[model samples]
Target chain A: MLKNVFVLALIVVLTLPGCTMEKKEKEQGYTARDELLGTEIIINIKNSKEAPGACDDIFERIKQIQGKMTVHNIESEIAILNANAGVKKVSLSQDTYNVLQEALTLSSLTGGAFDPTVGPLVKLWGFDSKNFGVPTDKEIQDKLNLVDYRQLQIEKSRDTFMAMLPRDGQAVDLGGIAKGYAGDEAKRILLSHGIKQGIINLGGNIVAVGTKEGGSAWRVGIQNPLAPRGTFLGILQLKDKAVVTSGGYERYFYENGNRYHHIIDPQTGFPSESDLLSVTIIANQSLMSDALSTGVFVMGLYKGLELMEELEGVEAIFVTRDKKVFITSGIRDIFQLIDGDFSYEQYK
Target chain B: MTVILVMNNINKWITGGLIVLAGLSFIVLYIYQGSQDHGQPVLVIYKNGALYQKLNLTKDLHKEFNVTSGGHFNTIEIKGKAVRIKEADCPRKICVHTGWLHKPGQIAVCMPNRLKISIEGRSDNVDDISF
Candidate 1:
């Protein structure tokens, strides 16, 4: 009887907190894992128990949602709807409808700066899987006729959309804003499932939820635009904040020693010619951060800061062609300029 | 007697497990800190252009490299082991203000006349690729 009692006590002692038993789980938890999203989508999330599975779940959801929304996939609802162009109405899933509605609203807010209807121009530039060489001015002009957000109508009441594209084939690609929106959704899903502290880095768009272990803010390093890799211009402390950087170096084909990137200006229908090398936007919303990073990069310095100041919670860091750093007032306090070539200038 | 014997063995095992865990934790901490360094060579700036500090792959501090007159303000060249900064004509001493490159991908710059000191490391295809 005494032996059994001692055994019971031993089990309790081993299972209790601060136990020296080797098999005992540590109070402090750490995890790291990779999540594959479709063919191209892969996101890594580091957290406690909810990490590995949550990351995988988020990627799976992204694939499922992308499959439904991608214009490239003929079987996708978006492609099928676009195939029957000049239609009266086409119904969409809630997720698709939500993304489109948000894109339209962002388009209005940025004054067509963040238009989803830019797909026509994207394809014309051959950035569409083919990445065909630059298009002629006349060809771009012909395609530009069908690339207006005002023409694309969204009826939120019925979750249906209608777009008026030319016969030459005007496509509406939500590629720019979709990834960010998906990141935001993935975070929301993770949080709902009791996973609090983590970061979702989708390409260059990063979202941090909650603080690190021991209640430390997540230290996020922004990449140096000119530097190749693992080189940071500075570090920012993100506490439940989403940061998205749009740079001239993210994607481009170099021919004859000249670099051509993915982010194209709608007005000229070519790569943006702003002095800014990259723009990183920090906000509570991932979609907004994503949308604004691209929009503000195209807006350049003056107008970009103006927009940053007008918005209550938006902060931006801009690196110009002259290697000068420009950041908004709010951003200056949070940003630590570690080793950039130039001092940071606050553009009113 | 049996209980006492078993208890002694259990206590020994517990202590052994704890020592093992403490050692493992220490090793883990060391690795984490080591990986974080990221292999950036350190370059410390000093007066006279003749005096400077250079840290190699092992990060062993080796101060005072031989300065050669390269016409530019203290130019630090990392050919094999030695690094030298050339002549500096600037009166403000801005080049001397920029410090060492401890992180793998970090770069220090003196923009007055375009002088760049950087740590060059192999690119690890990181997701975000932050500095």
Candidate 2:
């Protein structure tokens, strides 16, 4: 103890004069903030000469995506398709076709766990409106008939693109995958601006561009579902990847002590009833990880694990309701537990 | 001789018991530290999933405002550190039911109106942001 105290005192004495020495860092990259898609979007760059101009361009790109994809916007491509649902085939814009096509591919991969056609069910449950109420079994079943990706017909060519939903009651909402596309597009803009390293946080969809300044891997926190927001269960060390999580705590309603969230299961017309509380997906593209997070969440532990195994370039961390965390092989080495109570277990 | 053996056994049990107590206290301390909110609370309001405004909850007294978007209207009232949606034209009074927002990171969203309000702690110096 005496030797330790002596060393501590010596360190303090040696550092005392340096306390007044302040050095300001130049080339501190810009972080432009704006409200997009009903969430705060922050774009941070490591080093930049034209901070304002680059940030303006990044925000502009996000705005364009939001305008084209937002379902509520009457002039948006999605709105046009939704307006013509079950009526006629409507030609889609280039961006809409790509996002829709990606959603379709993801839907097929997850077996409809993450569907774009659940709009009708989302509306019936009043998740789309302020008239939120519980829906009857008959009501859910009726809407479920319209909520099939198979019924969402797609026709495309080099110059023109069109899509049609089978029935009039059916609708399409791309809330799940659009943000991922936004993150990916923003990354493109940042790279074009000569941003070698940066962080794009579009709400919870975090996309790390390259590595951090000085060549350190980005450390991302995973939300603790059972606790308040911003409280994390652990950290994920990643480089040039997007980390997205899907959980009930972000957006949900509690009625009679039962929690109902926006992620409706395509099989059932209600909030998914699964043993899992949250699922975090990491991948090269934010769109893939964002959509897969929800897809895996609805698929639950076993089937979700199967989905992760089949897909390449994808890693997942599944947190169950009982506070157990299961990690995919890719994340095993990089996953660091912040909360001691939660154990990271591997399952075959 | 038997008494001496019993005393020695009791001494061994005490040492083990002290180690166990230390372990339990360490766990409790860790939990207590994790539960603390490190920074000052700020109110952040979102519309259509984008941040519309951010206000310091501890300053400037009361601030009342109306958010109008796409023909939908919701009136927000902030008194001191608590905030709530006073009135909304949406069908269900879910936002109102959300009550007050006092704790940092607690969120109240009126999805129908495309309005969301959340309290942010000023001192949450996290290197990574979670979705």
Candidate 3:
């Protein structure tokens, strides 16, 4: 105890003058904020606490951003965009315009597999209202008729966007890709605030910014399909990478021992019957991960694996119905299968 | 006499318990490492209309032959260490990447020829694959 006290006093005495001498040590270079996207949003930012106003400033900025993008925000630009689907030529904020552009681009890239106009299909399935129940065949078919993304056109030159139905009257749904697009924009807003080292988990799509300190990689745990919560297969170490997981388990309804999920195949207008239960995609761009997660899930295993292999920077982990595990070559090393009596196999 | 006797009894009991615990720990560790050794493979041969056979690659590895009996041509290639696939013949080229089934979960699917080769591992026992 005497030796420890002597060392402590010596350290304090030695540091006291240095602390007073260094006058400009309080300025930090990190800030963060969170904005509610629709009804749910999870935002985390890590920065130096020396800057007192950075946190509050970031938080307020996020709220302001959400006010423009969230569809649930009644006066939000997105809500206005959705409300005036076919009528007046409404001008849009630059942020909203940029997000819509990305949404349209991703929808085209997936060949309509990841359509943002899935709002009608989602609502028909009762998933949009936070209700995880199935609708009838007629309802699905009717909604399917309203779910063509090609009809959702954006005339940016006129600052006008329209969701034109193929027939006389059909509504457009931008639910599938809006949250992800919003999350990406929110990250941009935070970055513009000079905030780095943060994660934006809107619904299930996640966008991480910058890299963590100490050169340590961020280990994101993938949710197990069979496990209720908190249980994970293994950790994937990421550095400025976004990981998005789509699974039947995330949202499903059990009726008469048959389970129906939120992910519907556009070709069938019903839940995908693919053997895969869940798929998680890791990409540098959060939007790609978001769009690819849904596209790959609907494509099933064969085409999904091929697409993953064809892409340069994308890696995926697929869980099949029989609990079989398949991982892309990019992430085979980092994934560790835990707590399961299953076999760890790689598709060459 | 009583004090000496109590101390002696306590020492013996503690020593015996430690020895038992150490032995049990070793036994458990050995079983755990040994239990992960299950290999099962499914090799599916695609033909005209029916799937020919689902062979277990874990049980057999060096089995090979040709896929030509008539003028119908199907290109076969080995892509990886233990995966082989048939490139073309008809509809789906899924078997093109299957290579030869050497690793677990490695599959060869012939889309046009309707052949599928899959190597399955010990996954049935796992109730869930968590994130």
Judge candidate 1 against the unseen true structure and give its global Cα lDDT, from 0 to 1: 0.66
**lDDT for each residue of candidate 1 in B1-131, tens digit (9 for 90 to 100):** 99989987887676666556656666665675577555455444433212243445443445443333345455454444323333345333333433334444454434333444545444333324331
Ranking by lDDT: 2, 1, 3
lDDT of 3 by residue, A1-348 (tens): 354456545545544543443442353334332334442345666545523354455446556666776555568765665566555445667666666677777767667777766766766666655455667888878878767778766665565543333432344444555555655666766676676666666655666677655555666767666643334565677677777888776556556777677787876788888988889988877667877788888888878998889889999988888888888988877766764645566666
DockQ of each: 0.10, 0.16, 0.03
**Considering every candidate listed, which one attains the maximal lDDT?**
2
Candidate 1 chain A: 10-residue stretch with minimal lDDT: A32-41
TM-score of chain B of 1: 0.35
TM-score of each: 0.68, 0.75, 0.60
After superposing candidate 2 on the true structure, give the runs of residues whose Cα lies further than 4 Å from its correct spot.
Answer: A1-29, B1-125
Candidate 1 residue pairs in clash (backbone atoms < 3 Å): A231-B131, A232-B131, B73-B87, B74-B85, B74-B86, B75-B84, B75-B85, B75-B86
Question: Which regions of candidate 1 deviate over 4 angstroms?
Answer: A1-49, A158-168, B1-131
Give a tens-digit lDDT track for model 2, residues A300-347.
999999889778999999999888999888777898887887887768
Worst 10 residues of 3 chain A by lDDT: A162-171
Give me the candidate number with maximum DockQ. 2
Identify the leading candidate in terms of TM-score. 2
